[model samples]
Target: MSIPLDSPALALRAALHAALVADAALLALLGGPRIHDVPPAEADFPFVALGEAVVADWSTATEAGTEHALTLHVFSRSGGRAEAYAVAEAVAHALHDAPLALAGHRLANLRATTAEVRRESDGRTFHALVRFRAVTEPL
Candidate 1:
């Protein structure tokens, strides 16, 4: 069997990126910052980064699936947890139970699992960690 171009992790990230970018409410909170899978060395304040996705096999006799543990990071030099939390809330709202179009897989379900906001060591940036659980099967 050929491995699909869009792997489970890739598909999940793509779906999330699309969902977040299209959400006007999220954009309102983000103020048009970058949402990156691979963020550069110096991105401006209040940008988003798609963090690691851990995938494990979850195949059944009838269908093959993967369980994805995904994380989205929000960085804000806006100097408080409020803006970051607002953006995180928007992300959660956008991604919870979202119907995402995968290239080579079908998303069985997606749900927000956890979220936390914290101040960075530098004392200015706020980091919002948002995690999700997703199940997908081959299309």
Candidate 2:
């Protein structure tokens, strides 16, 4: 059955964890040799390692159906926007190629709405607000 976005805390947490794992795996697959290591503190973003990840909020609407919003907090330790955007593009590509099985859920489709990069205070760190839709066959 389809579970409402606000259905339960445990379910949401489980979904978030699964998504995180899938994201990490995708990044690893793309980063290849560059995939050095992911720090613990970097989990604050949606796609960590080359960047961090965070699930801001999600909700279900009758008009649009189901939607999930997330932010990728990328830290350009090297202080380069190009590098950060490249990392973001890699993440977007990975997410676009991610399969439902990878998410451990029967997702009908996943679409990336936006992937713009923004600068933080230090200018070395950037944040990418990657919004996407996750369609599933019921729950």
Q: What TM-score does candidate 2 get on C-alpha atoms?
A: 0.54
Report the poorest 10 consecutive residues by lDDT, candidate 1: 1-10
Backbone clash total for model 2 is 8
Q: Please report the candidate that would top TM-score against the real structure.
A: 1
Q: Each candidate: what lDDT?
A: 0.86, 0.48
lDDT of 2 by residue, 1-139 (tens): 5745543322333453455455654456334323323556544333344333333234356422233444443445435566666666755665653564422334446666677777888765675555555554334
lDDT of 1: 0.86
Model 2 worst lDDT window (10 residues): 50-59
Stretches of candidate 1 above 4 Å error? Answer: 1-4
Candidate 1 lDDT tens digits, 1-139: 5646778778778878988888888887777746888778988668788997888999988878999998999898886788899888888899999999988889999999999999999999899999999999988
Cα error of candidate 1 at position 118, Å: 1.2
- Model 2 per-residue lDDT at 75: 44
Clash-forming residue pairs, model 2: 1-139, 44-53, 45-52, 45-53, 45-54, 46-53, 46-54, 48-51
Error of 2 at 118 (Å): 1.7
